[model samples]
Target: MAIVNATDQTFVTETSTGVTLVDFWAPWCGPCRMIAPVLEEVDQEMGDKVKIVKVNVDENQETASKYGVMSIPTLLVFKDGNVVDKTVGFQPKEALVQLLQQHV
Candidate 1:
């Protein structure tokens, strides 16, 4: 499936059961914008190997704060309802692939 969008209210349910990569970002973030296409590429290449989602920090402050997202472009990798790995800042597709490989 294509990358999904999640909110504070639906974060848990969407990320509950499988390997999910949650992008914590705001529209105004430059690096966040740069990583968008990379994430799309990963989603297309990885396919069912992973579920990708983006959470806009501006609108999902509660979830963002809950995850202690101190910066834009923070990534949280969730598996079976827990955060298994995390990375900060804009990352290349290879780095993202590495993260998924380590967890998924």
Candidate 2:
């Protein structure tokens, strides 16, 4: 899975252009670790159809604050640079895929 590192500078444009899923997480978060593999699986399964990006709350605080992400492992789906869907906490692969399909 290609997990692009999302930052304040790239968040708006990159996610807006096409189907993008930004996974907000921190390195020390347990749920974030649990969901990492699921995200990787999605990246491999979905291929280029959707972009999977990861934002580290510790590193990209500005981006996280902008999106009102108060929890770790927040999944935000963007379509045309606008938030279309959002999910918090660890999710199963199938559920994640379903969310991706909604925006893609």
Q: Give each model a TM-score.
A: 0.97, 0.94
Residue 36 of model 2: what lDDT? 95
Over 1-104, each residue of candidate 1 has an lDDT whose tens digit, in order, gives 89999998899998998899999999999999999999999999886889998999999999999999999899999998899999999899999998898887
Poorest lDDT segment (10 consecutive residues) of candidate 1: 44-53
Please give the distance, in angstroms, between residue 104's alpha carbon in candidate 1 and its true position after superposition: 1.5
- Per-residue lDDT tens digits for candidate 2, residues 24-103, read 99999999999999999999999688988899899889999989999888999887788899999999999999998876
Total colliding residue pairs, candidate 2: 1
User: How far off is residue 53 in model 2, in Å?
Assistant: 0.7
**Which residue pairs in candidate 1 collide?**
none
TM-score of 1: 0.97
lDDT values of the candidates?
A: 0.94, 0.89
For residue 100, model 1's alpha carbon misses the true position, in angstroms, by 0.4
Best by lDDT: 1
